[model samples]
Target: MSHLEREIAEQPQVLRTLLRAQAAPVGAIAAAIKRFQPAFVQIAARGTSDNAARYAQYLMGIVLRMPVGLAAPSVHTLYGAQPNLARALVIGISQSGKSVDVLQVISDARAQGALTLSITNDANSPLAQAAEYHIPLHAGEERAVAATKTYTAELAAVALLVTALADDDAMRAALNAVPDALDATLTLCDPIAGWAQRYRYMPQLACIGRGYNYCTAFEINLKVTELCYITGVGFSEADFLHGPIAQISPGFPVLVVAPSGKTLPTLLTFLEKLKARQAEALVIASDEAAFVHAQQQMRIPAATPEWLTPITAVMPGQVFAMQLAAAKGYDLDNPLGLTKVTLTL
Candidate 1:
């Protein structure tokens, strides 16, 4: 097995470790955040970590009822503009905790009076040192270039952080089931591997989702591009409808992550429209209704809470990307020009 596949299988245990070990630290950080009572939240990251931040954006917005913004690091790194962050909670997420741009943003936020926090695997890395508070991912060492365990570990940490801030026991309790759900997701690999062979020569594809799963779309696209070398793009369903749907034609591959949630009705409508366009859809859904429209369907565990779906829903996409890369005769663990730790200014 390639390192990527092994790392992919490690996710459930990584999540378990994160939940068990980080609870006390995250709770302490949550108490501090509540005392600070930031008016808004800002997150800075890149690549896979950025996708995790996108998940956190939706999570913090929905649960805390606070506005969340994804920081444009270039604004600080290049433009040298220091915006007022006096009443903001700034979070920097990096698997290695060594991204220069992420660390810079956290440092600047702190200088501007924001409460800074870091979520990372390396507790002693520069990013951890830069932030006022740190939540270690406890994901251990991840060597795969495509990043499997760290991505989910970051998601778990974000979920825990949000739950801590809200002090929502129900949400906290819901997280306990996540590891098992992830374990069950691994069972789809055999079927997904078979399905992925059809897309081995696929030129390009689209990944679409909405609300909480929107970030899943982006993460899936990233994996497909990085590992499978396919020109994959991710879109929010609303954005796809507005203009990009023109790019779709007969037999074009479109992957949709439509877990049962508040977003289901609109997603069903969108699926119907895709059917009308003759666009081939490979759907990841827990809803039975989604199977009728999709050319291929991968069912995740049923009734996964919408807020918690991001943690469970992303696994199939990861599996598909890995399998597709192998089918294409590409290296899974080492992509041509990538490394485990990427530092950018």
Candidate 2:
């Protein structure tokens, strides 16, 4: 197997390993967060890690009732502006702890008396050293240029932190079961490969989701774009209806991450509209009924909690992107002009 495919297959064990190793440290970080009692949160990340931050934005907001914002690193790196963060909890997320811009954000936030934490695969790396608290991903070394294990490990890290903060026993139990859920989700690989072959010639497409899986939409879109060299776009189900809906032409492909949740009703309605416009939809959902309007359907583990679905939902996307890139005869381990670690200023 290729490095990318092996890394993708390793995610179930990665989550199992991460939760087993980092639970106590994550709890300690949660304890520190509560003691600090920050007014709000700001996260700095880039590329795929940024998509994981989007998961945190919704997770923190829904569970902790804390307002979270994605930090614009250029504000500090380019403009040299220091915004007041004295009452904030600043977080930095990166697969490699080598992003200089992300490191600068943590350093600046610490200088401003903000409580800073970092989630990264490397505990000895610079970004980990800069934060007051750190949660190691325990994902080990990822040799693939496109991240699969590390990205899921990042989401698990974020989910672990939030679950600890809430101190909810039931949610913590749910978190423990995620590895099995991921294993079950991986069973869809053969079907995903078939789907990828069916769309091997696809030049462009749209990915849509809402609530927590909103991050899934963006992450999957990035995977396809980078690995398969497709012009993929991501959108929230609500936002797609506003102006971009007009762009849909006959036989256009749309990938929808529609797990069984509060957003399912609205997504069903959105699927109806896609049908009316002759847009074909491939839905990644737990609800078998959701396939009523879809041209293709990939099922995830049905028992995973809605909040934790992103951890499992992303498997099919990763598999599809990997399969699609292989079908297109592209190198899976290294994409053109891309490296394992990108340190942006």
Candidate 3:
């Protein structure tokens, strides 16, 4: 079995359940919010962590109406951006609580008066200690350097932060149900893996989303390139029409993440345009019936409150990238030229 196929094969029990259990940390983040609510919020991460943090930053600024910033660990240590350190709630997202650059960024945030919080799998790592407050991801020592469970746990932290900021108790309840929904999403991993292996040779692919998931497109694109050594691009549904449409040629796959959200209509409209352009589209949609296609559709569970779609929607691409790499006999546990922990401090 391919590394991704094996990961998917194991999803029926262990790691998938680990991904589902993310709600456990949500309560801790809620408590952290009550303890530290700064005017500005900054996220610390590197590479994939930064990709996840970018999604969280969008959720904070656009979803929760908070002043959120993406803190580059190098900028604080190398150039020294005081703007991120001033009264900001710096949340560091690292699988290992010891990423050198992420730690320095959080430490700098603290030195300049920002409230620091670290969400990491390693409870005892230095990154955890650097934060004034800590909400450990508890993904339980993910060995795969590609980082699946840790990514899900970080988004749980983001959802927890958003839920805590909202005054609506009903929304909090809705947010709490995400893990169960995520449990259902794990079922599609194998199907996505099957597709990735079959389509590995495709030169280009599209990963599109809207609102908060617009950032998911970037992260997904990153993963595909990082793992599969193939080129893929992520964009918003609205942004595709402006210029990118010209690039949609035959045999090019368009992977659309269409969750049933406020932007569904716009995304569907964009897909229709792709269809009219005669481009092959493989939609990873919750409402699969809404889209008719000759190729099989891999549908995950629907996302509630619409905003949390990115949390579930990104999983398929995560699996797809790994599967594509695994198809080429690449070991996903540690992709070449990648490290478990990145420390630049």
Candidate 4:
């Protein structure tokens, strides 16, 4: 197995470890956040970490009922402008925690009176040191160019952080179920590998979802593009209907993440439309009935409260991307020009 595959398989355990070890620290951070009582939340990240931040954005907005915005690091790193963030909670997420621009944003946000936090695997890294509070990913070292364990670890960390802030027992319990759900998701590997052979020659595809899982669509799209060298575009189901649906032709490949939730009905309707167009849809869903209209499906064990589904629903897509890359004879551990840690400024 390649390093990427090994790291991919390590996620279930990594998530379990993160929750087991970091719950207290996460709670402490939550206490700090409550003390600060920021009026808004801003997240700064890049690449896979940025996609995880998108998940955080949705969680904070829906659960905390606070406005969440993704920070434009260039505004601080390039324009050298410091917008007022006196009542903001600024979070910087990175696996290596060494990105120059991400750290700079955290520094500036702190200088502007924002309560700054960082989520990173390296507790001693510069980004962690820069933030007032740090949440360690506890994912260990990830040597693969395409991140696997760290991304899921980020999801788990975000879930813990949100649950801590909300102090909701149900959400906390839902998160506790994620590791087991992911273990079940890994059992689909044999079938997903069989399914991947059919798409070995696929040059491009679309990944679609809505609400919280929209970030999963983007993360899956990134995995495919980075590991398999395919042109994979991610879109919210609503946005896809707003004219991007015109690009679909008969037998075109489309992947949908439709775990059971409030958004499931709309996703099923979208699947029906895809069926009418004869578009091949491979849906990752917890509800088997939701697969009736799709060309193929991978069923994950149901995770409650729906919002927490992204943590587990994303596993099948990760497996599919890894298997498809291998089927296409690409190096999973090392993409053409990509490195394990990407530094952007």
| Number of the predicted model whose lDDT against the real structure is largest | 2
TM-score of every candidate relative to the true structure: 0.98, 0.99, 0.86, 0.98
User: Candidate 2 overall Cα lDDT vs. reference?
Assistant: 0.93
Model 4 TM: 0.98
Q: After superposition, how far is residue 309 of candidate 4 from its true place, in Å?
A: 1.0
In candidate 2, position 225 carries an lDDT of 92
**Clash totals in order:** 0, 0, 2, 0
Model 2, 192-222: lDDT tens digits are 7776778889889899999999999999999
RMSD of each: 0.9, 0.8, 3.2, 1.0
Order of models, best TM-score first: 2, 1, 4, 3
Clashing pairs in 3: 100-343, 101-344
lDDT of 1 by residue, 1-345 (tens): 888999889999999999999888899999999999999999999999999999999999988888999999888898888778879999999999998988889999999889999998999999999999999988888888998799989999999998998888898888978999988888855599777889888899999999999999999999999998879999999999999999999999999999998998999999999999999999999989987789888878885699988888899999999989999999999998888888787
**Model 1 RMSD in angstroms:** 0.9
In TM-score terms, candidate 3 sits at 0.86
Q: Which model, 2 or 4, shows the larger TM-score? A: 2
| Candidate 4 C-alpha lDDT tens digits along 1-345 | 788888888998998899999999899999999999998999999999999999999999999998999999999998998878878999999999999999999999899899999999999999999999999988989988888899999988998999999999888888898888788888865588877889999888999999999999999999989988889999999999999999999999999999898899999999999999999999999798789988778888874558878877788888898989888988889999998888888
List candidate 3 stretches off by more than 4 Å.
1-37, 293-296
Please report how far candidate 1 places residue 61 from its true position, in Å: 0.6
